[model samples]
Target: MRLNKVVLMAGCAMAIGLGAVSARACEIKIGATGPMSGAATQWGLAIKGAADFVAAEVREAGGLKVGDETCQLKVVTIDAKYTAEGGAAAANNFVSQGVKFVLGPMGSPEVTGMKPITTRNKILMFSDSYARDAIGKRWPLTFHMGPGPAAWGDPIVKMAKEEFGIRKALTIAPNDQAGTDVAEVVAQVYENNGIPTKLEYYQRGTTNFAPIVTRIMAANPDVVDTVSTPPGDAGIIVKQLRQAGFKGAIGRLGGPGTEEITRIAGGLDVLKDFYWFEPVFIDDNVRALQKRYHELVGVEAPENNFFFLFVAGGRALAEAISNAGTYQDAEAVAQSLRELHVNDPNLGQGKWIGEKTYGIRQELSLPFGMGLIRNGETLPVRRSDAPTDE
Candidate 1:
């Protein structure tokens, strides 16, 4: 009886020890705030879904290595409804949850509102906006993941002049901060490239483009460029422009505007002389990833086309945490991020840039691709200059 009692106590102790060891593994939480409802739901869904997918992938691969133990990743997404108030609320919720890393609260208004909350809590936010106002000293903790307005507009204007023989351009946008910023950048680029540019602004949700298109046709510019127009509105513009008999070239200083434009225009045949500053490098490897993603999720990749950045950011954060030897120290993790030279098939090779502009080395400077819609497919035209991390 005594020998049996001893064995039972020993087994209980061993079980408790193993259970404690299992519980020691950390649960890392990543937060994402974006417009998950209303017109911009696609953007939010893409960012959130990509982050969740990457976390799942990491979880499947035996979790993230943090010091001597493995940590699991959990992506917590909140819908901001494309409003500043919504963004602030989401940021507060993340603060309460003790989340240090956040993916996005896209658009100028959403990001602007979320900035104070994120700064107060020392949370690292990755912004997707190309507006210059979104960065700088005010939002020190925030990093711009997407390319700047000039990055896209410069090439598009150059392409318009050299390839399409476009000498005159007219720009239209939503009149919001992002639209205004992008429009200004594109106009400047066009002017510099010897293409005289005119500007027009419209309120958001203005579906009726009859008046707008009529006015654009009156201008009779060689190119009609849409700067930072949302997907739904972009489609409306394209369809209406065709109906209004504007035979000038159509172009986008921002976004590929492929699937949305195609669906709304009824077919690719409607899009004549269209060009875009593509966000993603649509190479063979990225195509493979997109196929696999569709198989797992039952839909095509996000129209935003920068879903790979979230995945890369997640992996980079995990690596940073491991290298820093502490998950709680955000500054150390940020430093690690700056030091990382990321080379992914989806994003291609790039590293942190923008110390001269943003007052910090936070922006990921990667090779920006330019393309045109040819036969219902995006065909690359040129590759922008990017400093390779040697």
Candidate 2:
């Protein structure tokens, strides 16, 4: 989890029921909701791919263990179209389908909208998105798989102190829950660390950022952490930053995690002057997955997103089901999940922490990629090399 550097291959298909299974006993009706046809559809599409892959892989391998039942995980994908209403509808459908376990609908509002449904039905919802006030209560069945935007903030500052000699920083985020949340967390840490922050927020989709740009530069912080979509939108902010001629050092919430942002910007080196967060590790197991994923999808996987995270999440569910030893009691899956633990063939060991209310804290191991943006690329600036707040 703390190491990087990769060269990997897919592993042999192993026995499903200890041999190799195409299908089997228990049927786990799990649902995944996402914006399959909206402006923010990229995330949903990636998650759909990830969930599908995980469901197939796990089911083929005999299914997960729950107490003593080897229940097969059956994933049902629902298109939310990036609307809270759609999410609500999707959650209702899942509940009707008797899906006691569920994944996500891309970002924040979806997670917030589905809460009533998940909570009412006692369905456990796991999201690749950050935590919000609606999900504020740690329900017995909801868990946030990814860290809040703030996840990378502390480490970015830590690295700044050690590497950039930065005591002053400017912060930018779209004026939304995800954006503001990341800014708040970062600002808190910066203030706590005794570093002054030139914090600013803008409407996420606003066209002209000249004013914001001018304001940020005027404050003149040593570095900037532009928090926005891990991909698409964040690019706009960074592009504006460069155009405005303010280039000290920048940290992005998850900019490097998006291949398009990197490729379009020219190369990974564009992020060379910025700090970025990586959702999954490129360990041997993960690399093996990447190879197989590419082979199957014919498209190289994005570095982050629910694309791979869902597979890891599905596998985690499978392991829990395997440990449960039975599949009859849907509610009991959490207990079974708690009892089982394995090195996620994707994320890493000890990556998931048990939080019954929120299911599993899917990625307990946080490995953020701190890189510098240069020539329109992100190069390795440094790595946190530790979990949580390194």
Candidate 3:
């Protein structure tokens, strides 16, 4: 009897040791892809920051449930170098590695490349591109993390007309897809409302906008609205407008409208009448997001698309993981994702923005807030959801 009792105690200890080993062995992998270098390096790095921060935050929070075990975050990053072929290859690579969810490149080319592979693998793709072509239409496994340029474009025009007292407008944009989309956004709304529009398009990198400036000056419209890419384009457009003696009203859709823009534009002094929508509004939601973001990244809150949208995206994915606990299946994750609120970044506050359909199938539009540079700061001009004629 003494020998049997000692044997039983040893067996119990061994079982406990094995169980601890099993618990410590589990891991989960998440993926993010972008261009990590070159002219667009800032955009790519911001995305990487959001993805890495979320993975770290989720891991530190004790990980996702997986069948009597828990797993920590294992983030996989692919550098597409901002190319279509590169993006397609990265998507295939992620699938080969058994990762089924991915965040795609922020621009049009990369998102276009990854679509096919994502659909085949049933990977849920979330993008930060401003192309309207991607939305108001559906892709099998693709989703948007924010409003399209078209979504915000028309509304800003209405604001320009009513708030700034302008009807007839002269507009200029680059020939790229994003620029075309922004111009179309304005035209769709303005044409429907019977407002006359004088529109012009240019190649992406033009050193002398003087010809275009001269033409717009000749038109002499009430508002000169412009939407272009990079800090360089906007800075030049605004600067040359003042330089070329075209003194009509100036409206800017500043994508590169970073704090850097005001400085690059020779100071906000030159951007007096420009307006751009804020990806994040100045509400409790944004403040709470900034706080959590600062806590995780050890820097000032990223004020661009990556900061706010990433927090929103991570919360959505985390809720899904928690709800689908103990089941690491892809279907389980996808289904649970639809059920999660994806609320505020504090991860403790603000309910998800949409109704039942938001989490379940898709969102009507990821929420956005509009703002204008007022008194040298981006001030909330109006809520993104403020009543409109839809």
Candidate 4:
């Protein structure tokens, strides 16, 4: 009896030791990189917040299952500072830490910079950037979070033209790849809609837009488009344009930042007439995501609507990881992701597109919305169906 009791205790001790070892071995780290500072800070925060919320949700549901072992999901975030160099450094950091999956690097320049590192290291990435080459056939492991201007620009431009009766338009942006790429696409859309357009660029860090505003006013454009300009810069440009006695409607065919722009430009009244692209249509279902995020993360989600998009993307990544049965094999996980049906409880159904523009069908096309502020009164966001390769 004494020998039997001793043997039982030894078995229990061994079981507990193996359990601890298994727990440590099954930790999966996901890397989230974006511009966590400067004017684009809100965009970056959305990426981090989405990853954090997804990690928490997985933990609350008894952890993520990868094959036989239940794995704990951990998010490791880095601020790419909205720059090319920053993005490359972040990718190197992730590789050194053995992180095989990545979530962001939101700006065009950052995506361009990070692609080489991620591709070389066989890391899979889901990125949000308006650059033309944000995702392509060369980088099979890279995916786009949503459609860029090339997908949704036409309808929004046509709506603006019909509603406001704008004649000629001018697009202003920073003189960088992030700006030029989106600006050219938006400008082409405006011109396609029979509205002649001109392109203007300013140094990225230019705080005062007085000179640029003067140049814009010289053309006497009936509408001015702030394509791909950072929200902070857009607000200043809008305020200066209004102050200079320009009564034309303002357009933003770039990323969503209406909240930040309104606050910086004083108020909606100051904006007068404005039209911009909203990434997600804020219906009750979408609003419910905020509640879930708060419940799991213990804080309010970032105000940027990009947060919702990232949440959808993050959940999809988790599913792919589980399906592939290993986070270490990025190619296998990428294959799993490509086979996903693109459905989300909150965001509803979506599809993978982009063969025509990017020469690859890796872009996630989800329903989007357009915001309008006429005579200082904000209207309901108008929903648009997901785009196709056509």
Among all candidates shown, the one with the greatest lDDT = 4
TM accuracy, model 4: 0.94
Superior candidate under lDDT, 1 versus 4: 4
Candidate 2: residue 9 lDDT (0-100) = 19
- Rank the candidate models, highest TM-score first: 4, 1, 3, 2
Lowest-sum lDDT 10-residue window in model 3: 1-10
Model 2: residues with Cα > 4 Å off, grouped in runs: 1-26, 35-40, 62-71, 81-83, 132-138, 149-152, 254-258, 263-272, 295-306, 325-328, 351-390
Winner on TM-score between 1 and 3 is 1
Local distance difference test scores for all models: 0.72, 0.60, 0.60, 0.88
What residue runs in model 3 are displaced by over 4 Å at the alpha carbon?
1-24, 38-40, 81-83, 135-138, 252-256, 325-332, 345-361, 364-367, 374-380, 386-390
Instruction: Give the better candidate number (2 or 4) by lDDT.
Output: 4
lDDT by residue (tens digit), candidate 3, 1-390: 011111111111114643642224455666788767643555666666677777656555555554455555677888866566777888899888887666656766667778778777877776666555453234545666655445456676677677566767766877766567667666666655566888888886686789888888788777776654555566677788878775455666534345645665677667666676555555675677567667876776654555556656755665565566632465566666555654453322223222222232343244455666644455555666522124
Q: Write the per-residue lDDT of candidate 4 for residues 263-310, one digit (tens) a residue.
A: 999899999999999888889999998999889999998999999999
Candidate 1 C-alpha lDDT tens digits along 1-390 = 011111111111123643653244467889977888765666777788677766665655556666655667778999877767788989999989989888887777788778898988888888777677767777777887766656556666776677678989999988877688778887888888888999988987787988988898899998888867877788889889988887777888866556777688767778766788766656676667677676655677665665765656665666666676666777777777777767754667776766655566677766666777644455565667543222
Which TM-score value belongs to model 3? 0.79
Reference-based lDDT, residue 29, model 2: 77
